[model samples]
Target chain A: MDKSTQGRLEAAVEALIFASDVPVAASRIVAVIGEVMAEPAPDADAITQAVESLNARYDAQGHVLRIRHWAGGYRMTTTAEMAPLLEVFLRRERRRKLTLPLMETLAILCYRQPASRPDVSHVRGVDADYALRKLLDIGLVDVVGRSEAVGRPLLYGTTQRFLEEFGLPDLDALPNLRGIEELLSDPSFSQEKARLFMLQGLSGATEAEQP
Target chain B: MYRVKLRDFDGPLDLLLFLIQREELDIFDIPIARITDEYLTHVRRMEAVDLDGVADFLLLAAYLISIKVRMLLPKPAPEASDQETEDPRLALVERLLEYRRYKEAAERLATIQELRAALYTRGSASAPARAEPQEVLINASVYHLIRALRRVLTEAPEAPALVIRARDCTVEQQQQFVIKALTVGRDLEFSRLIRGRNRIFVITTFLAILELIQRGLVVLVSTAFDDDFVLALGASGG
Candidate 1:
């Protein structure tokens, strides 16, 4: 690649990582930078190196920035040394400690919103009355409307803050857990099966998925 | 011997179920007079019960009182010809019976939550010191049970000994220290970040790096062909 073309690729990658609120995965960085620069960076290693060089330069210059891997992907961030800047940049306030059950309930509502409390309970293998009420109290889940079935159950949905906490933009952006929709519809997927589905779906494969 | 807040009670149905459990009464053949009296007493003791939730409890109460009233009136002018020989309480009896099943189911669900929680503590013990518990949590609907379990988790009578071999260091405390250091330094090297740290400290530092990156406070950049990833944060962090 020509010197100017390589320079353009570096600038584009820098912009993408900087603009991202969460880690920008290496593959994602490669795709976005490659498209913008319109030059073949060939091989994953080539892209990886360019990204690393940029990181070195930034560190040498003491630019309150860094990229670290989390949740199986790389992301950009302001160093902990400069975490105080968040006093101003934190638009979505952090919550009180999120207990495990609270987080799971939030996940169900987030992934299967426009869903009923009973429906959520079904998938979780428990009565969700208390959990649903808790979500309501926190304002993270709301009674969006009613379900289509009899009893016209009050349906629940996740708020935007729920998405922000996971650094997800929308429901569709959430990593898939296979058979989730079917499990909600039937509420009988055993805990073992659900766990396996999440592990599998996380690998970006949808094969052998049972409804 | 204990009083639970209305918020802690879940719902009126939940309160009613709690009373049943507390009294050890058979739900299939409820002692209507005793239960009705006790339920009203609890309601009088607390004023914040939701109106709609109360209405639901009251509707069932009304049905029970009516059944007793009808059972009291003799022969009702030959029963007005439409009433069946069956006890009027059958319908309500069926409702209480049905509702009890769901209550039992909810309780069973709570047990599952507790079991799941125990599993987490076990997993935490086996994991690398730096590994925090996974982010996937038990749902909030079952959080009450989790609360109960957390109470149990802390019940392990012995406190861990505080040793300075980095054994005294907790992940939370370390996360904060690393974040503070990075924030003040503006930028730091991967090796520089781990200086004079122990193995456990190294793991936590790595996790801190991951957490910071996840939060968008760290950025990793590279040249066209380098394996050495230089970690950077915003202009104020390294």
Candidate 2:
């Protein structure tokens, strides 16, 4: 990693991130740079440095777009100041919130995955087909594999996009699941504490999640 | 006419939760026969409105009815012990509790979705790169199309019942009509296509639009809910 080569690597990293519409992984960037330059692949640390340097440059230059690390990869996105304008330009409907049914289905999948549709339906006491299809269409939940249960139904799991979209670093970061026994112990749990907690939970989204 | 929009009907579990809250019923020990009657009453109202996606609710109603029937039946020899003979309501209660937990979590996720929607990305680069011809449409489902169809059908003037001959508009004929309409006037409004049409004509045209979408002849585009879709020439369209 000579001074000139280091500068070229940083430039290459920037160019790669800029060209990619999806997030670019550090390992993938290293492989591409190694293949293109016909040299040894740089380590992940080098790529991280390049990203940090690029961010610093963007900050110093007051550029609206910045390379963001999300879902274990880097992608270029505009600053929060630009979100309102970009949304207008994109003509995105902000009212496309996941309905309560869809959310309930997603929540079951999130905590109990990789679960079968039957499993989810059993717990929710309703047919999960429509909700599952909608979730699959939206790219939040995916058919991970077939379960080895009685009929070997398809197992569903949350995608990496789920983590990114939900502002969770990983499945481990999901809020702790309250014990069923604890909930069942209180007779008025569902109507009282659960309802209040859900209302309070609406404020779960945090500022750190902003791109 | 008590018209209910399809969006107004949440899942059956939601309706059950609402009924319990409204009736001020006990969660742990639900009065099955009473709740079933209330739930059926709600279902009857939805049926009157002719809601399309009420099958899920109907299925739950049937299940509740069965549970209510079981409650009427005598217990099996008092079972082995109280622990062995689990209360039937116990399972239903647990299911409701679990669903309630996830419903809350989903609301939390909804906040995240709103926040994520607020965060902006670079211009065209915000779009995901696709190896295949991506599902290049908004979150518009068949439900939206159906709702549009319902609205158009309802708005169309009532055809006289005494007509000697039925106005037969085949799907194939409607397909040709749609293509011709789009070719002559690109990006035509969906409502305009079905406006002033009879019930049969409106249905056939809706089917034709779906076929055109399938064949990549035209694409449906809308930026807002309940907004009329524009039928524009697709990539493969002439």
Candidate 3:
């Protein structure tokens, strides 16, 4: 393609991603650009190349925004460096750290998609009803379908919102499940445990005064 | 009285994992006797605070003690061809290992979430329109409020008997009571609202709060304590 044609395609891709509130799929972008240009639709590869070129230009020029491929689509998001100022402007609350229960319940559903309440509960050794409901409220997990077990319980799975929120292109992008030995050896593990113990100590001191 | 905070530990397995990690014990060869003793201490602490899910911890405590007993019991004589005896701790160890894998996965997810929080998308330039005006309470579901109510109910003193009283405490009256109380102070701790009240009064007030929340007259905000929540004036409230 000529330089002007490539520039037009890049500009079109940039416009679509910038205007879209949700991520714009490559096919939708191709169709839109193809109809506007009155030519054969550009393939996914062309769109990908356009995105790469646009991102490259943005990076070379030190632009704050970048096109990110998330949840099977392209989205224009501000670079991480601008987050602090953006957060202040947005008045965003400190992101609600997922409580331990919700995190555990989410991890279980993430790995074992379409799992029932009983399945999660069996693994965690506690009723997962509360955590599951909280996750649903957070838009991370959703009822995908029903199980084929005795009572046919509702099966839950991670939602598209989950993928987007985690910045994962797909479930395949999930970090590898580290083995127990590796997790044990991780220095962060001990640090987290120590922090939890300190929290426990503070709370335990308060509890001693009660009754 | 080391009250086991439900938020800190997800469940019984989580508590067990904590004990093991604290001691740096080998997961494969957990010393059941020592771990069981430490586990019971934490369980007792949970009971002392009347935590929401102490029963789950207690159940695991029972299993741990049983394992300790089995370890103490004598083994059968070795056959001509020695058979490998199954360790009583084997099942528990496997369960712990499984739980650990997911726990680690959860941490990784948390990290991913943190990184994702930094990137601002189109609609995320401003705070997303929320159902509740309070951002903290956006994640606090009705179930969480109900759990807090459960704690209050358990702690409430029983009603006095032998008094044939009229059914004067209706939902509307309690609703007015809540609204009026909040009008005095913009925020009210739920437990404080029902403190020194009878069972009927407490139950009626709880129902009133639920109704107010449904109508967007009040919002339930989570406090530092899991068993307690704060009620604030909603967007439409007086």
Candidate 4:
């Protein structure tokens, strides 16, 4: 490809990541690029160079988002400089923060876990698929395995981050439900979940937590 | 007891909404029995598989059974002064509905992040770029698509009923597999290579991936859904 085409390709890749609300892997980017481009784009190296160049361009100077490699994908996110405006996107007023639902569902899972989605719905009296997805995206809950019963069900459990966020020493340290009242009062429970999760990450929890 | 991961979450309301929506029932009027069945189906599916994605969904199951029982059983009539008997789900459901609205707003705001990235070229244009979301609207509407996926999953081939036994898949094997495919075919879709393979092989596949990542021979990525990681042959080793 000519230099201009290559540059356009790079710009397109940057634009896609910028537009993505969440992180996506480079393979997804390559697939989208190939679909749009008439000729096969120059290899992934060129794409990587293009992304790196764009990242450097945004980082060296001031830019809205710097390309971040996250969750095994490339995504565009706001910089700390622009966090206030993004907070506006968060919209605290008149909004039932995610804390309530997330906490409610999380409480159900942590306590009555190895249960089913229906079991959770029965207890919480609402569908939890969305929360489940959000939880998955955040790296909080995970599938433990199938039930041994005639009708097996997926079991849910808390990660080390769950302990870290709650300021618990470990899963064993998870306090009993007696603190529900206190937990219900703290609206930041979900936000805290997100905060500690982002800080610690899904995989490197303890090492990152220790810091 | 492996830890649960929650990265795919939209919000808490999304979870409640999913429950309400699962039975293809109204959010206001819940068909407890059917809802329970569908809910359990999701749970059972999780129990059947060992993927991390199903963990939280399972824990919520028991709580669901409890609410169903409470709603089903006739309670002693509260005295005139007694607080009105609540629909056990009332508090939690309301919270879900409310959170759902904010979550939508968050999604909108999140999309703006995407537009800002795509439309603007920092320093090049004094003014910000306009957003482009024409085809973007064509996303799997989280609500409808999930139910549809659940329905389709019923028919998806039973991967295997026989061997739940864990295997010791070595990374060396996956590296060889990636190399094997690349050597055989010039190019391959990532999904095609990963599917129909043994579980033990996945570890090896991942090992091969990391090895290639280090050697600069192969690249792994997902095309659309984060469901599968696609591998593309890079030029370094080739």
Candidate 5:
């Protein structure tokens, strides 16, 4: 495309992202830009290129704002460097942090989504009712469906709000869940277990007596 | 007394992990006797404090003691290879390992949440509005009220010599009592509502309060201090 056309496309994408309260999907941007420009719809690649050029310009000019791909869409967000000032302005310091139980419950649902209350309780060895309720209140979790197991308990899953809050572009963006074999293979794990075994053999009774 | 609060640990597994980590004991070869004794000590202290969810801890303690007993029993002659006789600790070990994996995942998520908190989005500046600054009353959940009830029960003086009386009290009666009490006073502390009442009365009143909350006849609110909750009239109640 000509320089003028490329410039207009970039401007349109930037405007859509900036004007949107929530993240704007690439397809949505392409359709709007195509309809407004009265031409064939631009492909996803062109939208991506426009976003890249916009980011490049922002970086070259040291702009505080940049477009971020989040929750499967593009959103305009201030750079991380501005967090402190933004925190003060937003009073985000007062924001409640998820408690340990809540975090654990959320992690379980995130990895083993559509899980029942009993399933989560079995893993944590504690009733998850409170944590699950709190998560539902926070809009991070929701009842996705009922399980097929006996009694057909309600199954919980993470919500789009969860993805946006965690800054995940999609569930696929989640960090790879470490497997049991991987965890067991760590040298430190084996070494620690061995050392403890030896210690137990040496002074089992005395160690048990210690406060 | 250094009371062990429920909030100090996430759950029974967390307490077990703490015990294992603190003693540097091998998760694979857990010193069952030692861990069981130590776990019982923690659970006793937790019970003494009357913390909510101590039942879960006690359940783990029982499991540990059972494992310790199995370890002490003489093993029957192996019909085949040594692997035929399964270790009593195997199930527990697998459980601990699985819980540990989730705990690690939780930590990783915390890191991600922290990093995500640092990045500001377009609407980040306009956070949800806070409650009126003059009085900060938090909306209390059933969990919070349960904790408060535990505290009240702990502080309650023991009942005098038991008298055989007719058990006429019902949840409906307690509900009426709560409604009447609320009518007399604009707001009522849960502890005060059940104060000096018999155990049966306290329990029935609690159930009644829960029912009231469910039916939109009552609401539980608390200040920054969470030791207790206040019951106020709900929209329907008003």
Candidate 6:
């Protein structure tokens, strides 16, 4: 490709990503450019290179926003440094933090997709009805389908926004589950695990308080 | 008796795990009889506080008692001798282990969520518009109803049941009272409606509000969280 064509492709990629209200997949970018240019679409590699150059250009220009690769696509977002400014401009309130109960319930559903409400409640050792309802309301979880297990309760799974909000590219990006097993087998399991469970805001004397 | 706050007890499994860790007991070989005794003691404390959701803890307590009984009775040896007899605590231990794993996972995910909080995105304004309507209408509507009732109940005078008297007002009568109260031109504050009333009257008034809401006789407008809701007569009610 000539230098002019390469520059045009780079500009096209930047423009396409900027104009998109949602994340623009590489293939979608290629398809749009191909249809408009009335020529063969650039390969995924070329598009990726174009995006990389576009980002470099943005960095050199000290642009406040840059393209972010999230959930298998690219979208434009302001720098993390600009968060406070943007928040003030938007008059945004502090988003509600997930309560410990909701986080526990979400983790169970995340690791155990297609799990029923009873399955989740049994694991958490609490009735997850309210937590599940809140998660559904917040769009972090959805009733993916009904389980084949007895009673055929509705199966819940993490939604796409869960990945997007968590900055995960996909479910595969989740931390290794084996970490928990390793932590459990450690000699100082109780202390370390209790400290990790700061979700409840109780750090010390957790064991001493038990009957 | 050591009193565990209701909020501190995450659930039965959380309490049970705490007990096991505190005693340094093996999960695989729980001392069923002793743990059951300790667990029931904790349940007694929980009952003292009148915890709202003790059903799951009670269920676990019952299971622990059953396991203790099974341990007391001699079990028949397996005929094949190939498989060791299943421990009665096996199911409970498995569940505890599973729950512990997920709790750890939740901790890990919380860290990730914290990191993600640093990353801001566009469309916060439009996002809630799409997601809020259904949840706000169905869930928040009922939640606000309960909250409003609680607020009004606080203003109500303490229950004076010591002075025995015949029931003066029925739910239907209270419903009529609400209708008459809101029949005036302006909307009424929930706290105002129940203020200075006795407990029975306050409860009946709340029930009346619920009944009116159910029959579309009144509309509840809560301008902000935990604020007194304005009860307006619905068009149908008018």
**Tens digits of per-residue lDDT for model 2 on A1-211?**
7888788889999999888766778989988998898567788999999999988999999998678776667877777688778767766644356666778889889889999999998766667897898889878899999999988999999998887676554687777655554444456555464454434331132122111
Q: Report the alpha-carbon TM-score of model 3 versus the true structure.
A: 0.68
Candidate 2 chain B, run of 10 with poorest lDDT: B129-138
Error of 4 at A125 (Å): 13
lDDT of 3 by residue, B18-100 (tens): 88888987665688989998888777765755566687787788889998988898875667334435567766865776787
Residue A41, candidate 2: Cα error in Å is 4.1
**Highest TM-score against the true fold, candidate:** 5
Interface RMSD of 1: 14.8
lDDT (10s digit) by residue, model 6, range B121-175: 6665455424232211122322454567689888968878699766778899999
- How much is the lDDT of residue A27 in candidate 3? 95
Candidate 5: deviation at residue A80, Å? 0.8
> Residue by residue across B96-130, what tens digits does model 4's lDDT show?
44344334433433333333333211222332222
Every model's DockQ: 0.01, 0.25, 0.31, 0.02, 0.32, 0.25
Q: Can you tell me which runs of candidate 4 are displaced by over 4 Å?
A: A1-211, B1-16, B119-238
Error of 1 at B74 (Å): 22
Specify the CAPRI tier of model 6.
acceptable
Supply the DockQ value of model 4.
0.02
Clashing pairs in 2: none
User: Tens-digit lDDT track for model 1 on A1-211?
Assistant: 7787767767777777666655456678777755665567445565566678777887999876655444334456556554344423443222234443455566556556788977776544446787787767766678899988999999999765444334443556654443423432333324454454345332232233221
After superposition, the stretches of candidate 2 with alpha carbons farther than 4 Å from their true spots are A1-11, A36-41, A49-62, A92-95, A160-170, A173-211, B1-7, B47-55, B62-82, B123-238
TM-score of each: 0.32, 0.60, 0.68, 0.29, 0.70, 0.65
DockQ of 6: 0.25
Q: For model 1, what TM-score does chain A reach?
A: 0.46
Clashing pairs in 6: none
- lDDT by residue (A1-211, candidate 5, tens digit) is 8888888889999999998888889999988877878766789999999999999999999999889888889989888898888878876554456767889999988988889999999899999997898789778999999999999999999998898888899988888667655566567477666445335332343243222
